[model samples]
Target: MPRQDDAGSESEHGKIPKSTFEIYRAEGDSQFRNKSFLKAIECYTQALEIKPGDQYCLVNRSKCYLNEGNIAKALADAEESLKEDAAFHKGIFQKAEVLYFKGDFENALVFYHRGHKLRPEMEEFRLGIQKAEEAINNSVGDPSVIKLRSDGDLSFFYAAEEKKKPAARSSYQKPKKEDSGPKRAQRNKAPADSKTIKKMLGDLYADREYLEKLLREESAKARKTEHSEKIQDLCIEGLNYLDSRSEFWQQQKPLYSRKKSAMREAAEKDKSSAAKYVIATLEEIDNKQTAGEHEAAIKQATRLLRTVEKWSPEDLQNREEIRANLHSLIGNSQFELERYDQALASHQADQKIGEEHELEESQARSRDNIGRVLAKQGNFSEAIQVWEQRLESSKSLSPMESTWLHHEISRCYLELKEFNKAKELAEKALSYANQMGDNQWLLNTNVLVAQCEVRLKNYASAAGNFDSALEHARIVDNALAIDAINRAIQDVNQKLVEEEKRLEEERQAGEQGEGDAKPDEAAGGEEQQQQQQQQQEQQEPVQQQQQE
Candidate 1:
């Protein structure tokens, strides 16, 4: 709900409050267009509660439910919507489709026939009738004999046997006994159907005419499976999409048609003709991958990984890029898995090539890799020292102080009992980090400073710092920082108790010594008084100054 501050400048609907018909209608429309079906549900549910007869809300809500495969809710919605507006064609269509999907073909056929009678030229409705008839026809087959093979042998016995067999979940393991080997071997295995049939990656282009055609077909199907409508159509609509700078939906299409056309036009005489074309296409794809372009990188990485696998490690050449990207994928996957050592190694492999080949970004990345691995191992001193050198040597922080450098180094110092240094550095990091508008990362620096204060045993100072850190971390909902603070609170409390105990012990010892003093000094008092009077005369001005 939007609130108005006693000003007419606010919209009439502003003060209508949340869950109102107008609010839900607006939000539902926006979220539906944005393809957020779950969010649209929230909005539609709101509108339906407020205005039960909102035609637009019900119809759209039905669409969201259908998309989410909630067939029951979709059926209820379609029926309820038709009750609201009997003449609505979309609702009628939805009702028929829901009935069909639910296998109530008898009622479905009746609804489809009625819909078709009203709108006869609709091919989709006609298809629905055909599907209903086909289901009715197929219903006569025996359940046990339904899956007879091409040779007319019953498959249920074999299929049931396979189902009972245990699958090998580990990628590296062999399947359990009952078996024929897999038709599509698990990842890390050779292609299950045929060793020659390698996977076509999303963007990888096959230059050979036949190979390109097959790869494009598979890629198109894959894109469709992934629900990427635009990219899927690219295989057939290559030229149309490739010509338009904005039509990136089918960018992978160019790899098939364009490369094949070029290879076909150049010479169809030899495999080398296609190989040369493939090399050219690969180079273009590699450039996009290296530039941090993600959509194409996924495609490029799979292709590159397979290409490297085809060649013996020693025989591979000039595909420094292929190796680099494979390593990048390995490193990223390992990083996600928290296999820091393996991740660092893979990152270094790529980073090493980029550096040896004079790539500055690669060198910076290598340094970042070293920092990640070292910090994970709790070698904060070296990691901090390394990043400080990098920060000093560079004219300006690369890409917003590379937040990890500042944050990781600070964490190290806090761990190593170097509180002042950590707090000072973390604060400095926040100054530069905020200017770059990386607000969350900047907030992280504040949290690090708070952590340092806690480590320094400055409890009075730390409480306020921790409060601010908690507020910011809550806004970001940063899990790591929240966990750190919970631990910090416990840690600081223990340290405070220990310090107070030590101070009280020392104070008690001083009092005990004073209480044990002897009174035998009375005899010597006369001599002592004469000496003390002389000392007092000498120290009187100093004592006065001390009193003042």
Candidate 2:
């Protein structure tokens, strides 16, 4: 089995990032070279999941399936590999090879011819054609006589009826001479001597003048000088070079060509084995968090974050986005654990990345998370600011999300004793809830609105809103909420009664005070009249004195 640790690194944070697809595919190739077909299939399957419809992965997987003797699966993969491009030469060769292995020599031959027509430079197709023909000849005797015209041209369509019968032989004895000269063809078969060797070397290496001269000198030295062993060694070296070249073109180059094309496209998307693995690991962290394994999730996310920080620009397409998400994951896990300070830092980091990159969605998420963390820590003022900023800055927020944000903001305002602001936001939240038609949100928002009203001393309105909330709670079948709303309604009704009594007492006090003020006014007028009469008398005396 392949090393699981290498498949997913836990702590190699400073290494150059390799693509997930490249890593897995390269591993698959290694396994294939080792004849580990099952392991190779696993690796290729992973590569395919990351990059669907990859020609190299599909064809290589087909080859693995073929090695496993899974003819059906092998053929299916081979056929699917060609679906994108029928002229994919590797796919053609693989399909033809599979058919030939499955004993369908006729179809194999057809595909081989097709491949040959498409890519004449490919030696595999030529070899396939020859094998398929041999298989056909072995399976069914060649009834039609074929005439070899020059070197390779053949008269393959000659009718069986055209085959001529041998003519009747007439016996005529002739005397044979003893030890007659060897036939010209017999001498041609002998190993070449010095002069003949020179001529053969000249003709053989004509295209390579350098090799011709080298071989000529070597051959001369081998025959006439003491460097015979050197010439022999050189001959062996040449044979080995030819074998290696033939093997490379026949076995390796075709696969390399297929991979080159796939890698070109994968590069454009910044996809690789390591990148895909990182994505998968991120999903795993999400699952762990969802499953309530907060500690484990935090640990995994921390390690992955370290690794991600070392990633090259070419390693992953959304490097910054992935980094922000990792921060979010860690923050969320910390929040779940009630580690408010650590959660705040992580969320702040996430927000910083979002703002720097201008990622709207990331910014929205970070703000929401940070707000929740702050709210949990009793920092309602800052939490409210964060949520309101999200509401103002984000246009892509869903109606449900908007309702939640408004509702949260109202709660924060209510916490700060800002009744009017709380009431306004609560009403806004209620409208959004109505639009979404969510009974739970409706119940929650109505209760919130009622609380704001109560804080504002609107007892009657609070009672009415509580009744509305109670109805919604009933619709949602929330038993706890039903009991709570009933108690709240009772409290509001009591407050209303108290409010009415207070209003009545104030009214009576005003009426009595008005009556008393009228009496005082009458007495004061009488006193003023008396004072005016005395003043008139005094004034008359003063006027008489003044006239004397």
Candidate 3:
């Protein structure tokens, strides 16, 4: 989770010195290597503070941001670096990559040409050119169109402890030729078997090559003879095959294009055919459940339940895309019917299926949905915990996904009576929603912000957020958002009016008490004066009686 302190920007007091570029770099690279991207962002931010256009850090750091699923930061850094040096191949390539990732394919293609022109003979740069060209041909060429959680940390995707097979039980023994010995893909990395290896030597070297090719510059420093030999070998072995066949490559393009076209057509047919029958059933159940006949919905759900139960992994993967939709329908129906156990049970069963799957993306989504169900039951803390875990595991979460996380976090903060944190997270969620252009999420975040204000005793602000929520609700055409906002607005207005009336009544009571006290003091003074007058009158009466 990003620290609450990162709410705005760096603090003025504890400012990192402007000269500490090395420290900033250390922190940035450490976090980048560890895949702790939010920290890396902070580090890069500090570095940029010291030196605005640190080209090396800016370019490398921007790529890290992209890997961290921060498209805006990546775009900003890439654009800024490119501005510094328009023909700088590294920065230009980074810009093109960011553009491609952001779905700016036409502009990305144009930049790709510019980048390629700067380093036409470079292999990696040519690959970027190839990627752009392919995007134009595919009509779906946005390379930057990353799905949420698409990037798996190398450590996560490739497990560290390989489970030994039964045949390979002997410890300290090398593998036999029959097993082909783990693909040998991480090999061919030795630098002539002479130089002591740096920890990130391979990956660093690769990145530097990528940088030089895209930057249209020579290597940063002259390499060791051994290193030169290795690079030369790679140049020969990697792109040399393409070079060897370059003469005839254009002739093969037509055949390749025909095969690709046929494959795409077949894929579309397969995709269309793979939808589940459960979708229609889910709709029918939803209507039935709405009509207060939840048993009918449950019966409808059972149609797919048994089929899903009997499905193999392949079947589930290919044909059970509607499982979530159908399950949600049934769960809603059961809840409306006052069958809490059944509703919870249905959701739990679906959660189990998600747990059974090994796909991290699917698993994160499952956890998020489970947290939603828990939230409906007012288990806000538990829901936040579930999503916090999911968010932590989720690599490369986009802005929309982050909105979901922050919105959920705000709800949990509300339940915990952390009103300030709740409001902050709600506001953060709104910002992310705007970034994602997801109106529904924006509406939800606005409504939550209103509720947070209510918790903070800020009635006027609550009313304002409620109005904002209603506006967004109208834009999104969300009945629930509209209803919730209207209710909150009315509630807040009534509360404010009542509070005003109560304060007026209290003021009037206080005035009446003061008036009563003054009269009491006057009455005491008058009684004493009257007593003195009576005494004097008695004395005078006695004197007059005496005179008479």
lDDT (Cα atoms) of all candidates against the true structure: 0.53, 0.67, 0.57
- Per-residue C-alpha lDDT of model 1 across residues 1-548, encoded as one tens digit per residue: 22234223446665443434676678788898887999999888877766765667777888787666565566667777767456667776777776665544546666666678878887556656655544432222111321222222211111111012122132223577976664421112111111012122223223223443653566656335533443333332332221121111111111111222221233233345334544555555644432223345445656656666676534543345445546655564454345678777877787787667664444555566667667667787777766776666555554344555676576676567677987787677666656654434444555556556655667656556556655655554444345545555555556667778988999999998776664545657878999999998999999999999
Which residue pairs show backbone clashes in model 3? 89-214, 89-215, 90-214, 90-215, 100-144, 101-144
Q: TM-score of the candidate numbered 3?
A: 0.35
Q: Pick the candidate with the highest TM-score.
A: 2
Q: For residues 9-54, could you state the per-residue lDDT of candidate 3 as single tens digits? A: 4576775364467777787888887878878878877777777777
**Candidates ranked by lDDT:** 2, 3, 1
Q: For model 2, what is the C-alpha lDDT against the true structure?
A: 0.67
Candidate number with the higher TM-score (2 or 3): 2
- Candidate 1: worst 10 consecutive residues by lDDT? 154-163
Q: Candidate 2 — which residues are off by over 4 angstroms?
A: 1-272, 533-548
User: Of the candidates numbered 1 and 3, which has the greater TM-score value?
Assistant: 1
Model 1 TM-score, all chains together: 0.38
Give the alpha carbon lDDT tens digit for every residue of 1-548 in model 2.
Answer: 33445554446565432347888899899999987999999988888777877889889999898767566567778777877688889998998887776655667777888899999997667767765664443221121211112221111112112122232121111335873632211101111122222222334334334543565566665355536545544554443333222222222111112122222234346557777777678768865653345788899999998998898767666778778878978997787667899999999998999899986656877898899889878899999989989888987765667877898788787768788998899899999878877665677678778777777788788778878987876765545456656766766777788889999999999999999999899999999999999999989988999999
RMSD of each: 27.4, 35.8, 26.5
